[model samples]
Target: MSQNGAGVDLETSLGYLLKEASSALRAAMEEVLRPLGMSVTHYSCLELLAQRPGLSNSELARGAFVTRQSMNVLLQALERDGYVTRPAKAPVGKALPTRLTPSGRRSLGAATAAVRSVEVRMLAGMTETEQAGAFRILRSMIRSLNDGDGNA
Candidate 1:
């Protein structure tokens, strides 16, 4: 393996591995989410809002690892679909907060079940200890790649 301009070897690059794994992960998650009438993107937004309960579009974007502009476009669609609400305008005249509607919560709850089912299948070959160790190793690798900057 040789380092190129980006300081990664094509033959043994973390980016390549991560990209492939992420694609697979999304595909599996999407398979589960689709039956619940949701895309992975929409489910992610709903899950984030469910957890934080009133995040601005920008904040939700960052938390969900998406661009602010992209998040706003999705939010608009969700709002139109009656899956989310924007409440009143923000006090700072900045980004308004978004939250899931009852329907969104119900749909996301169903999708969450499907996601867990996929996770169980993905981890079927591993023992509980091995699963934890795998999670630790991946987290360490991500931390090393991110350093202190994160994906921001």
Candidate 2:
């Protein structure tokens, strides 16, 4: 704690710690994905599609935490490269559902392995119980933050 108490104590702040952890994790993931010609968002999109096929662009954008316009640009490139496919016309509304091509699946397989390695490395010092506790704690933090009103 600071004597003046004028601002946050970054060393003991949970928000600062969480942001630091997130940044480290992102850097590690990027290092592993670089050789595979994939970015974090690209891998996220493919992983999401593999788990949930027929996801619309907007849905994918949300899942990947990118803007819809950025996702659309990526989708266009993926479609052009035959990594994914969307129907010529929407079966329902203007939302075009996307699916992974065989190539995309193969690519995702490698990316998944890489990501798993990073996660394993990050959790190397933790026991099963500790990991479970961490999961619960992190989920609680997320829920609490999301459930809060504007006024803290």
TM of each candidate vs. truth: 0.81, 0.92
- Encode model 2's per-residue lDDT on 1-152: one tens digit a residue: 45665678887789999999999999999999999999999999999999999999999999998999999999999999999999999999898989999999998999999999999999999999999999999999988987876866
What is residue 45's positional error in candidate 1, in angstroms? 0.5
- Looking at model 2, the pairs that clash are none
Cα deviation in Å at residue 93, candidate 1?
5.7
Candidate lDDT scores, in order, read: 0.85, 0.95
Q: Candidate 1, residues 1-152: lDDT per residue as tens digits?
A: 36466756666876788798789988999987877778888888988998899899999889888899999999999999889999766857687978788988887888888888888887888998998998999999878768867455
Clashes of each: 0, 0
